[model samples]
Target: MSTDTALQVHSLKQSVDALSEKVDRNHSDLLAAVGKKKKNKDEGDENEERGNWGSKIDFFLSCLGYAVGLGNVWRFPYLCYRNGGGAFFIPYTIMLGLVGIPIFFLELSLGQFTSSGPATCWKFAQLFRGIGLGMVIVSSLVAVYYNMIIGWAFYYLFASFTSKLPWSECGDWSSAYCLDRLPLMENCTMRNWTATVNGTCLNGNGTLMALYNETLSKETMGIKRKLPSEEYLNNVVLGSGFSDGIGDLGPVRWQLVLCLLLAWIFVAATLSKGVKSSGKVVYVTATFPYIVLIILLIRGVLLDGYQKGIEFYITPNLDRLYDARVWKDAAVQIFFSLSASWGGLIALSSYNKFHNDAFRDALLVSLGNCLTSLFAGFVIFSYLGFLSTDLNMPIEDVAEKGPTLTFVVYPFAVTKMPISPLWAILFFIMLVTLGVDSEFVLVETVTTSIMDMFPQTRKYKTFTVVTCCAVFFLLGLTLTTNGGLYMLDLMDTYAGGWNVLVISVCECIAISLVYGVRRFLNDIECMIGRKVCGFIPWVIIKYWWAACWVFITPFAVTCVMVFSWYDYTRLDGYPLWADALGWLMTFVVILGIFIPAIIYLCITPGTCGQKLRILTNPLVEWGPALVKHRRLVARYVPNYVVDPWGKEDQNGIAPSDIAVEMQKQDAPGYTPSPEYYAQKM
Candidate 1:
């Protein structure tokens, strides 16, 4: 009885197993047929559905333009001097290695492999989609204020056409206390006149008041004449727009409004056709600035004070590197200079041809950005050095920072040069060029996010581009008003500064912690090859990318972020509410990121535990853009799981070599034969 029962039970189990296998095979077969049909259909739609950069060079130039922007030409040099001069490079390069290239590579590889924008790419973890949203928001805010600065530059360029640079001497609008020739060194730093009067309120004691008056009377050349350049910026061009406190949003400066209008028009025209127009535009906009920079550099070094200014620029105060603020500045500078967490990098890289070598491009572009900054430092400080000598001032006192460094001080110094107006035109033009080029990428990032989130938007791409421009124009109008400078300060401080740090931190956590760095590395390995030898490995040269993602980047960003919060410096000069408004701009972006997470939890199918798993899971749809990409990925990342989309061998496995073995490998300078274009292209 027992033998018969055992035999019957065993036979029943075998029958069940066979039926189950047949069902599974049928399901796989069904999926295969469906995939084949979709593949055929996608081929027909691929032309319009997928757009790649016209050539690798175009992409490289576009990246160069975006990363080597005003931040490099204007912000970086100032930050270098203001922080610790040559010592700034220690923290800067360290942060660049820790956070810059890793994040840059992360953005580029994410876009190229997925062929998507930041908003849609977060499908890897639905909960992390807010990152893309936050990025877009940050990009949008930056686009607004950033263009405003360009408007200012444009104004200066137009004003430079005067027979003699108006800023060369005091005009009728100059203050009674104005000085035609600004003092050298410490003298110029001392408020020319009014600060001494105002100092009385702070120093009611007769002793302090007498000391201030004695210093001013002796050092101020016995007159309170405004520096002609300062007067020009404060009165002639700006038209006393900053006259009142930031309490009132005053009338729009018509000249600035026109300049802003012109800037927007240029951006709209450039980006209307999307990457095609921007790519071609970058060829000029990106390279022209370097030409001007070089011209100025040559002009600058040949001048009198070049050595002194450059000395101040590169002279290391090693002690300053130990300060937390210096470290924070380095991190923030790297973030802004490289355009990280703004979505622009992701958006720009999204247009690349599938299987493009994004890894090499990332390293090259990131290093190029740093080199460009150092070059810019020389170009800038050389002039400041000359200016310092001209004014009999020390480099520290006369080497202005930020907008003052760019617009007021630089223009003032140029006035002392031969053919001042010509140099002025070139300098302002360079500023405008850098400004407009960077603006292109920022707006493109916003545009790409919208197009991806709602694919239907592509049908009205022209309309959408116009709408974004119009919207940004309207928002930027506030910056065109008298209080616009304050508005720009507020937005720039909030949007691109600390908030970007938070966004960077979140990205590292999302990919490395939530989406899985291993998964991302597999994706990267597919588009670009495995880590190779040479000066190839950055820093330690092995698993450097992975180390950045998991350890270095997050830890570095966190240290800077925590230090920032510890001191929490707000953009000074405004009221408490102005600072509050800036904080609001930051939080609203951060809060928006959580919205997607909430939506994911509600709509995701599964038990609470299952939903949590999905929150932490990578979608199967997330992977290389096509089979070529998958094959490349398979070569290096062993045992990687990918959705082959039914491309399988007889053994029922996606053979590592089957997909790409026959394809020519990418060599030192070797390029893939263009399936749809010239091989080199």
Candidate 2:
């Protein structure tokens, strides 16, 4: 051969070798990828196979923290007050025992059994995971707006430092030194008082004369009775201040924005590390609100006339209890206050490790939440009583609505006391912290569900979650505008109010009926390694609980609708079209939970069965068999093999195949061991 031909041949050979090597690497990488996928599948199966276990004490605390939030503090007391004062507890306790506790246990058990978040847990019960998805979405929306409120609280907390008195600022423009009137007063003073180009005294009065002045005498401010007039009360105070004023648009706006940023930062810091970090963080976050509650209660009760507030709270008007509305309100309050059926609990419980005892945790957390709410009521009512006495008005007159109660009445109360600013700052700070912790959990639930459903995005889950939260915060800016309070009322009543109660009832029925109470009881037993001995589960599942849930849930919902319709029709000046839209929105929000559940039930009947099998079959098959054969089986079979015999196949057969064959032979998997099957057949 020619030398050139030989060199060309060598070059061709080298090229072929390089190409072949590249193919080999690519094949290896592909195999590795496939292996990783299989490994993930196997791990997922293992996760599914594991029984629901209760968490460590710390983890349980975190889960409880997520459940106990701003609702317990800000909303529940008002609910109790409105629904027959102390008389409300009668229905409240009934609802708690029949609905709240049962639902709490049910949701926790479902989550633990499935080892899935709300989105997927519904799938386990053969309910539309979309119901779970809708819940997750609604919760996300609520969390967004909820955080905006937290931002407001934080802003107020910050503002308390700068203001002479945070809560008691009057909207009086005539006060020369007050921050609110400074701009208008400045222009008026400058225009009227400045010497003109005409060289005459611009005003016969000097610059000081142009400035508006208030007659600051004891009569002007001293001991004004029966609370401030509605015209003087801002939405923040129930006085008729400008809705979308400089407070919302100017410095207050900046403060609110800063609060949003801080909220984001705190949530990110708490949840970025996932459940381990979140669990630890909640120990402080969940409990701090209570500390504030304790402090407020101590201070409040100690104040003179505090007993009047307590009386206002606890004095049962027996007449009110006779009203169906009162009972209805109490039921609604219990549902809302406990945060049941909100999907937050489902999502939080999903993070619990297998074997985490959620049963005890659920009971503890619910009780703790109730105690806090009760104590908070005492704290708030005591202060209100003081205000009533100070103003020499009826408690009803001095008492205000929700936001007003916090911002106006509470502040007014503090102002009456010495060192008002200090107390105001503390109170708002407590509010901020309480709201922040709850809001964080709400957002985190959304984040977790999203991450769980889209595992491929795990690498960037945190970024995606944070971005979603940022967008939500930005959207919430609408609420910070003048019409924000109206919007808040609309969302709360329509979205959070009626929808929450209805969703919870459906959730309980879905679990109890579709999944079956026995399965759930089994799941509880497995988690705690003890039987749940009683007629309680039977009573809840079969008759009383479901009946109560069915009756009360719809009634509560109708009340919301009726109230909304009446308000819009009578008060809001909304058009017929607006009413239609409002009803449509209400339907959509409530249906958000139900439609998904119906679809899920229709599509996946075996979902719950499969999960129960995973959780219970392992123990049912081997636990008793192992104990029976402990002495006899050891000589022939190793403990590891015997312990998980039903879980593992002795031969190379698949476990599913073995399960199938065992079923065919009408024997449990463990009963037909290799030795016994060989002998019998």
- The stretch of ten residues in a row with the least summed lDDT in candidate 1 is 201-210
Q: What is the C-alpha lDDT of each candidate?
A: 0.78, 0.60
Measured with C-alpha atoms, the lDDT of residue 179 in candidate 1 is: 56
TM-score of 2: 0.68
Report backbone clashes per prediction: 12, 18
Query: TM-score for each prediction?
Result: 0.81, 0.68
In terms of TM-score, the best-performing candidate is: 1
Task: State each model's C-alpha RMSD to the native.
Answer: 12.9, 15.3
Clashes of 1: 12
Q: Which ten residues in a row have the lowest lDDT in candidate 2?
A: 619-628
Instruction: List the candidate 1 regions with Cα displacement exceeding 4 Å.
Output: 1-47, 181-225, 240-242, 531-542, 627-681
Candidate 2 lDDT: 0.60
